[model samples]
Target: MAASLFLARRSLRLPFPRIVRTSKWCGVPALGVHTTAGRMNTNQQDFEKSQNDLKILKKDPGNDIKLKLYALFKQATQGSCNTPKPGMLDFVNKAKWDAWNSLGSLSKDEARKSYVELVNNLVSSEAPLKDSASLSTREQYDTLQVVSEDNITKIFLNRPEKKNAITLQMYEEIGLALDEAAKDDSVITVLTGYGDYFCSGNDLNNFTSIPPEGKEKMARDSAVILQAFVRKFIDFPKPLIAVINGPAVGISVTILGLFDLVYATDRATFHTPFSQLGQSPEGCSSYTFPRIMGLSKAVEVLLFNKLLTAHEACKLGLVTEVFTDGTFQKEVWERLRAFGELPKNSLAFSKQLIRETEKEKLHAVNVQECERLRERWLSEECMNAIIRFFQKKAKL
Candidate 1:
């Protein structure tokens, strides 16, 4: 929702994680050299362990559990919900279909992570999910990894193979994650991505997958979603941080304006190619970018589709600091963990003081930008540009 570009979806597939399945996962450490094999190995290890643990459970985990596990297994083994929906009268498969389909466009890796984390929780003699505050704790995210520890709530955009692109479902999930983080006890919140890329941009499938007659509705709805997403940032009470582990694009880059701190790796680059995609800036970038950088520099980025290296963005005040890629995560997260130990209400109050005066202006800019984007989504220019993008992509 915070993106600028309407980029093509990554058509490539990652090799399946061997023995991948569902279990609960949390406390995700900062990623280091997140190669394909390393990710597969970690998830596979958890999968095997959870399966072994599942075999020894004395009691059945119940129908709901069965459906969740089945759905997760399908998601982990296959990808997304590409299967046909079950007929309504067929209660059993219908329930299963509903369960699986609810995952939306969740990538297989994220589904595997969710599956592993859920299974781990269920294996517990006292499952936190059963008759407890499961909404904040046990409910598995389809496209994100969220955990609160060390007084810091960390939200990871968990789609690595697609370079952490923001799918339509991911947009919703991120807003929800931020909502939960805001209400939680954590003194600070951190946002980053899984694997290689911070985020490429909004998946253009959000636009291309429109129903035959739904383009108008889709555009309007997307504008509303984007508006709300930016509102979450504007109104967030706690200190929000962005840990830019790698290259960031689209909303991922633009939305840094709303964050309290943006720590990036030397490898990170910031890009917002809105004009190239026939889109306008969302995330209040129109207003904030000019304020953060000069109007001239902001125009270079928002209009001319400029790409900024981490150091360049830092120099422009868009990023707080840039660390060498070798120690980026270690150094940034160490400081964040320490910062999270600060007095909670004081941090929140201080952040509110910093953001309160501009909250109204930010909200207005979000509305204005989303309105422009809504128009762009249906424009002839945008349609032609998108068609050209897909055509070029198909050849690749």
Candidate 2:
């Protein structure tokens, strides 16, 4: 929860191989800075090397399992650059498969990089793009068949006109999905989104429907959705990944901490901004955010209502990876398949062990903090402040 600076949703335009220089307030040099014009240039040679490696991966049948999986993921997730899905595995000759298997048996780093590259290729691919069609419709919601990288189950999110905000019913639907994923062994992962946003946290418009006394219940309900979602994610012995397409604020970004991996686009922005808006952190972020990032950084994010760029979040270890906007979904699958290739039980065991060690203590802390914050929120001063903030934003 590092307090984040505002991020413009524009595409990155970094100059290559140039150096930039800056002196910190404490006379510290940032780890990756080069001296030029206060900007760091991405090395062109590195980009070329990445490209060449990808080209070899795509062309060489030696790496076909990873390649075919990457291709399948690209097809499933709507990426442009992909090997055709029809007979994708069959397309790989035996020699190529042998080569890929042999390579897989080599260094773990090489295999991991190879996995990332395949995901990156699928994510950054630029042809044969598919469309996410709406598969079901309802009065206030529509389910979509989103582009996903390597999994069979397609994700569905509330695509109502109201900015795809979460509602009680929507939470129920989402909860059911997670439960289903937990039980279904074939479903290795689930990717979620809501229209242009990953999720806008809660639909505050629903607040008016609750009586004043019921506000506490509303807060509790919100917490339940968040808690259940995160708990299922943390305890779900399989790999779970979230591809954050855009502004994953409040609970959206918070819940991401529960997942095994998260991939976000350059356009993605994460924020809490809850304390500033008169609410406290939820989604167990009160605990998870602080652990993943230190308390001071988390305080900066939560207290200031800061917004962070995907790149900044990556640096803070919030986001697992970032991709350009166009390639975001494809890149997500790349990350997902890396998880898919591992032995399922081993992955589950590691995740379970991690959670088992910390669950009781952190969960209690989260509950206690949330309760205290909820009580504080009921104060007249907080109410007035919330009203005023909403009024000011409304006028704008």
Candidate 3:
């Protein structure tokens, strides 16, 4: 198993400085605008204010409010949503596209003005924007810490008491952070865990709280959110690095396969107990692990539930390096800073070339895994296992 894994790892090693030239697709042609300098400044001010209001409203808004905000923002920025409507079953996307497209022939300035007015009205009647933090200012999140400086963004899993267990909200916040990282070309993202562990995986309390009758609904809903979160990582164009501080389990361990680099503390360990939990593989590990660690090692980790030490993980090529616990975080950050100092486009395009070939296959596997996971979530075996697992935790 080790020999085959080693040979497979050799095949997956990235080629440096090969410079694969590729054509870039620039989406949405720029619209011509004829406005006086003073008018441009006024329009820009209104746009900025509208953006701030939208950010404030996003703190806690109903689905209706969110859709409205999305529409107004898109209209103001893009000038009337020229993209084709999403498919029928894509209800959320279609609703957003329709809402934006409804304001047909509205000019950018007019849309911006309308957005400001709508936000002001919403704030006055329903909620006050003053009560919420502006989106421009980074608010400290409950479950994660996102700090960007020196051209490196570090996203830390902050719920140490629960062993950094990921809640649904944490997943959303991580997705948002990734979205931000995608927009900013200057920064590289580094994901790490706080306290003694990287991530204990999903907070089972959230999953077990679903009533038996609501299992199917919860399965579908959670799958949608989880799939979106996983897709964000898979499609992330910028360099993403993972720093494993300690032991990691479940999705936390599997997710390392998607990162551009993974550095771990010598004390860190990785385990995927999906089968024990009556669940299947996630984070496209079903596809990526075999490609990284070979089929036999992938089975041992995903099927037989093997727990690998950091050194073993590095040997299997899942981790780039394993550092002593004392200096792990510092060393990882230093490397990230060094990486950030390199030519940004060169790194990004290199990563793109390396990953673009596997993008379609990874997406397909993610879809298939989500389908299987949904079934597993709704199954009697999974339900029973979850109950027992919770009972065991309670005893502890």
Candidate 4:
């Protein structure tokens, strides 16, 4: 299924007119030509062009292509990959880290040249460019509505009847949306729910669907995907803002800690019931919540299973602001659109500066948290807790 999704996404790429901006990089020559342009440093041009090419890619690239892009981008921008490879169990991060590191001593200029050539080849072979809105609207998953307009990408959780309860497929779609946002420099992402509830967290059916004896494989795969999703949020280059239109529960609440800004309606509430569910924290909330709200507050949410009102969450530093329920969406969109209008590169660079110091630590915590959560998911306590939860819900 994963492989098929990969192929589907990659199958269509719109041919884009060559647009390169001029900038200087460490002693690289400025080039002028049809595909290449004037005043831009060769390396910088390649880097920007590669980013543009990535934006047009209909799907996430294969691991090899992704690794090459990661390595080349890092080489061109940061000179080398300094972070250590993630632990083996963290297959995704390790693959990414290793890919960047594999460039070894490759010069920035050479990396830039190779990157530009690769993108040029891909662009030449792909489909003609379509409207940006068309690309964003093309892949509509059952549970997500991804709309990109005026430099803002809004992802609406669409399962109102289910209180927007998330399934594995929803996770995949959200991850893909994030991937697309990452590639497009102009887009700032906003996450919200379609109806009254932001999300009720993981769909219980997702848990019950796994066969009892063969659950390990499913659990492992889920852990990888979930961790990858959270990691994408952690490492998202552009601004990510969450508009909490209503209540959010479990992983939904935990994810708020990772957003650049969070706005909630007056009637909105937040809860992380990891302890109540006999689950350890996911989403690296263990690390991020403490950093954002202090250890005591983090414990209150994770260990004590406290529900936080929007005002209370704002007071605790989890929410950026709260708007009246009637005007919530309007106000949030107004702010997001204003934010989107600001100088794009400045926002990106500032975000990068704020995040750089903690990047490695966040990845480490994510690895640790996922491992512990995997253990908890398989525990007898968690099994009993699940049975009890459904039984209580059934009675209600």
Candidate 5:
């Protein structure tokens, strides 16, 4: 994101072309472009060409990236966010304001360059996804293996070496996979891991490594990413399932509240050590955890860093069922494949009815959790805690 911000800023010395939104364009946005002939340098020419290409794209680059592009364009063209922040209930406008405001005092030239580079990348990378939609060709993602078959789209977390711990790129990839699955003909979408562990949660490197943009900015960017990532699950249309092949931790465990069904292996454990790292709740766990497991149990895991066994999690309503380790995959897949043959529309509509009333509350909780986490990430306690964590790991 920092690199993209640099490229986007550098490319913006020239004016970007205006974007017209008619529901056909992807994430290019609807910024008004300046077309003064005198300013049409080679860079501006490339920018305009990129704009043209972006308007032709049929696939979205996900909501987070779109907000990013929108913010960059706004900063590049009209200077820093000047409009009054929208009301709390105005989700769309408020989100737009937040994205643009997160840029802080980034100069117009920088914003322009960032917007152009992002647009170019979006245009270039989009075709591959479109072509890969067919069952004959699986969707290509950097950190996820997405394939549709037997009326189900299975998204496998492919970083076994990292215990499937998610990186920033992985978050984006998973969201994109979910977007693809949501619209595809698949009756169900299954999230699982490639290795023995379902997901060990956050890749600590994300916290330890500070980019040139600095820690606070990275935290801002990460919060944006986090909100977008969780939003995918919150708004997912199909029956989303978690096939917990093994241990799950951090956001991986927190997000299960959003899944329609969670099947775990008897050996699988769930843990959320938020306070251990001086971080606050995220993945909307602040609300969902207490609601699902009651206040006492939620406080134990979320505040005191308690870990839960598979059976315990199941009893708490986090996991729907648990199978023995040896037969976990075989039994789970056999049942899932059967479930896939169910009526897609019926399942979708039923889920909608079940989820409709709570969607707004979930979205609100997501915003609150993400914002709080962003502040926590920028706190002295969190930074020092992460440093100590790395030091402890080195000794072991």
Candidate 6:
């Protein structure tokens, strides 16, 4: 059993698409208007404009005066809604829980655009905003639109075409985003992915694109990317939560092993079929799976290539909780917010200590597992198995 486990772990490979590059942009396109150097100037202008508008509104609280002034401001901004988004509004409400009675008449569109621009500004500047602590934004792919919500401190993985299959660029962007989050005191927790489907795992198309000869290098490099993402999630003092909405396979399922809390929908599925596919789990599942789910359960999941439903995963201690697909988001929000509502600093410190102590050893184990996997991926035996599988699929 131990030998089989070792062989399976070594067979894992991280494939990258040679023909296509992973995008750094999360989901938004480049405006080309604000350069990184000039982002500060743009933000200062927006900040000043917002401040001036605030002063006028404070001077006159009367409905007639406030309405007239706000309307004019709206027109000047081309009638764009300045109202915060559902996620942003939630944060604002928390900050000013007592004062926030009802939302004022403001345009949602205006708020969204403004928020996007602000994020772009920070990305260009690579600097945190004055009122805001840290901000990082990047497009994950050319076609996909993955934006980090303003107040939620969320990182959305949004490549629907390939089911959010992670690429080299996506891994790099995620690593940088976490680094930025680490620097900011305000960012207490990091939430990942959109509704369902955290990540579909490795892009199989990559097998055909890259030089098959360099397959070993590609897998090793990809392992580095997964290592960075998992290391950050595991070591970061802040809470790391993964909202698994749909299918999570391969590296996706393994990466979840690092998250402190995981909430999956009833329809969600988690699996690591590397053995069936003739590979292994690169994100340190060799070590993490056995520790979290026990050796017997880990072997059942990794060696047999079994797909576990949300309920099944919960039974194996893989998932924290499961809810109906429709109500998953609402329930997750309520649960996370309750945690966020606690003394922010104290919560952060406690989370950090727990992660550091437990994850420190796993990090080393992950490095060892990944290095060995690269060697196996380049082995002739595994190569022949991969070739046979693909040839069969092509015949079908």
Q: How accurate is candidate 2 locally (lDDT)?
A: 0.52
Q: What is the clash count for each candidate, in the order shown? A: 14, 22, 0, 2, 9, 18
The models' CA-based lDDT, in order, is 0.74, 0.52, 0.69, 0.68, 0.74, 0.55
TM-score of each: 0.68, 0.60, 0.64, 0.65, 0.65, 0.61
TM-score of 6: 0.61
Q: Name the better of 2 and 5 by TM-score.
A: 5
For model 3, residues 31-114, the per-residue Cα lDDT tens digits are: 334456987877767656545554433222233334555666677667767898899878666777787888888887776675
What would the per-residue lDDT of candidate 1 be over residues 1-396, giving only the tens digit for each residue?
226333434523323222223343121223333337876887777765655666555434344455667677677766777878888777766877788888878887877776776665445422212343322342578888776666878887777666778887988898899898888788998898755577877775666566676778877887888888889989989999998967888888888999999999787888887776677888889999999999999999998989999999999999999986544666677798799778999988988888899998998899999899888988999878767766876896
lDDT of 6 by residue, 1-396 (tens): 111112222112113221111122111222233335566556545534443333322111122112222343333233433344354446423323222213244453444344333323222211111234333444444422333333335566655435566655666667666776666644345544532245666555444455565665676665565566667766666667777767677777876777778888786888777765556665667877898889988998888888899999998888999986534556676676566566757767887777767676888877776666666676776677666766766675
**10 residues in a row with least lDDT, candidate 5:** 1-10
Over 4 Å off, model 1: 1-138
Model 5 root mean square deviation, Cα atoms? 20.3
Backbone clashes in candidate 4 total 2
